[model samples]
Target: MVKSVSNITPFTLLDYPDKSACILWYAGCNMRCLYCYNPEIVFGKGKFTFSEMISFLETRRGLLDAVVFSGGECLIHKDIIEQIRLVKAMGFLVKVDTNGSKPDVLQSLIEQKLLDYVALDFKSTRESFLSITQTDLYDQFEQSVQLLFKTNIPFEIRTTYHSELLAKEEVKDMIDYLKFNEYTGTYYIQHFKNNVETIGKLPNSHTRLENHLPVNTAVKIVLR
Candidate 1:
């Protein structure tokens, strides 16, 4: 059974693709990224019932085009397939936002044709991956990238650009790494936004502001 999560936003135009969709924010992430903005969900502070989410979705049946399962990490729950099926049964597209550490589960979902789109977050280069994510899943991340590259599913690779953690050169290195692995997908560079969670961890000075792009850049890779 999937763990019941909290804070269900029934309608959003930004979370999903071109169409409007609902987001199901799952609670509790396995990795610990220091700059995590959603510390409530990551630290297990949010709570919501699945039945409540279902009721909300039922009210917006024809209004929403997709159901985005975002989280602490949706794949962490074993009942992800069932949740996807339920969303699909409602005649809504399913999009999963994951970190791509659980390749086996992700591959099973793709093979079963359960997800239409996936957004995988790549924290940093393989060398600093463990330091950033606080996990020894460098090999798992590589495996997941390869699986997504071979799959028919459309997916995107994204990384949050926080000056404290990664430099501009390292961002380019990440893009080069993905290109080397034959991953022809959209790569989005999201900038770190300051909030309560990142108040103390971020830099106080603006000395390195000119080191990289000020805003995030989502570059689409054309796989040859």
Candidate 2:
């Protein structure tokens, strides 16, 4: 079969909350986020085939509790549904990290009960969505969010905050959007790590996030 996974993180306790997991870093992404840290994964080609990945996972059957399908965008893969089914059949819980551009694929996974958890990237407010992600799929992202809301699966909505790309007001708008949609989950604003090379040249964020955060909002906003 054709290769699709660029690399594999043998183990991680951080990526998947409360579960010991391994990360499959798939190659390529639909969006060109300026602050994307995985420039290599986004622009590189896969080094491992599905068979290779499964063989690797087979060894960790009992050691690992879950598998994190992270990418460039895991849902963009044509055979993602089947691939996920194979993993799920191995008695391993599955989690997907996505940009929320492929709601149709997300919906399919939800309907098939393939996903145990999800980490959705809420790039920015609708007005600056295109400027940030370089994609005009805010509607699709919103659709994905709504789909998750109707499901019983656990999920978290997070944003990679960069002082240059997004303002405190935009973050408030996103919080407002989530509140308006009746989302009662934690909204994470992760500060962009400046140590790594990004897709675009970005300077280190000097602004203190705590000072700019909205006060006493209904949605639980956490800075990571």
Candidate 3:
């Protein structure tokens, strides 16, 4: 069977930031983050081939402004570049949501000018990266960050904050790392949704994230 996207959200307004978009959820991942909400996508197989996705896009070309390629780490898929090319040919902008485990794939997309925007997940500080993501790819994540830094393309670095998995100090360390790298964009801290089923067992956070955010950093911090 040809590995392909697992699902599609036909339309969404909030995901692409000011543009109407649809989300393509790819299957499988290189990391197993404890708090990942999309365990089914991470563990399951693709449901839609590229041709099917393209046909779906063809029907929505005039209605949607962009396509958000998300996943189980969308970059891990081998056909992503070609898939993006097909989507782009349809006159839709492309956005990718990634965990930054595949810098080489990212670089290829960037070089080909296939991506219009990116939402990169900054999973954890280097020391705790393995514990949170269950993968030793912090260096690859860092390399992806650097690739974004060198480009003119717009992107956002965000972290899913679950107090039990990440401490206030660790969040600060991540912010400091971004600052030291001279990242001058907004760093979004999205609170983990308590009711959703996660990849691992977790307790609801009792602490307020607003109180835990670092004070007056060079990077603009936004709680979402």
Candidate 4:
């Protein structure tokens, strides 16, 4: 379960696939990625009680088609299953955004059929994964990846184009990582926007994906 949620952005179109949804920002993260934009939740700057969150969701029952539980690592909280169950009982398709840290929790949710979609962040090549997440997370990430691959549920792998951690060549390594594992879901190469107030630095502008790889070529590899 989640320790608590700190914020709710109602009626988000971009979070859940093809459905109107509410976004729940869970508090606390195990990793300390310097590039994290939601530091308020990550650092526990503010918190919201579960009762208040449930009340809000209850108010919008028919208006929304889904609920997206984003984090600060949502799966870290032991109460995650309970929360997902509650949301599912309310008849909302649930989507989870995770960093692939808690495979056990993820697996349990999958077994209980709690999620409709999962968006997992694949941060960097294995060699630099620790540096990127600022944690010794290889084993946990490996387990999470395995669990996702084992499941037939629809999912996506996302990468933020961080010049400090990834490059043209490194993206190729990332491609190889996915191909080797036979990950057959959608892969999104998201443009990294620098929020200087929160994250404090911009990635090198010269290293945009379009500059390094042609559009068609990048998509072909990314969608692999």
Highest-scoring model, TM-score: 2
For model 1, residues 7-63, the per-residue Cα lDDT tens digits are 787678887769899889988888888777877788775466666677788898998
Poorest stretch of ten by lDDT in candidate 3? 205-214
lDDT of each: 0.77, 0.92, 0.91, 0.80
Give the per-residue lDDT digits (tens) of candidate 2, residues 1-224.
78999999999999988899999999999999999999899999999998999999999999999999999998999999999999999999999999999999999999999999999999998888899888899999989999998898999999999988898888888888888887877888889887789998778876658887778888998899
TM-score of 2: 0.97
Model 2, residue pairs in steric clash:
none
Task: By TM-score, rank the candidates, best first.
Answer: 2, 3, 4, 1
Q: On a 0 to 1 TM-score scale, where does candidate 3 land against the true structure? A: 0.96
Better of 1 and 3 by TM-score: 3
Better of 1 and 2 by TM-score: 2
Clashes of 1: 3
TM-score of each: 0.87, 0.97, 0.96, 0.89
Model 1 steric clash pairs = 5-48, 6-47, 6-48
For model 2 the local lDDT of residue 58 reads 92
| Per-residue C-alpha lDDT of model 4 across residues 1-224, encoded as one tens digit per residue | 22388788988888777999999888888988767777778987336777778889999999999999987888887788998999999999999999998988999999999989999988877788777778888788878878998888888888877676666788877777777777777778876665444443545434567656544433334421
RMSD values for the candidates in order, in angstroms, are 4.1, 1.1, 1.2, 2.8
The total of clashing pairs for model 4 equals 4
What's the distance in Å from true for residue 177, model 2?
Answer: 1.1
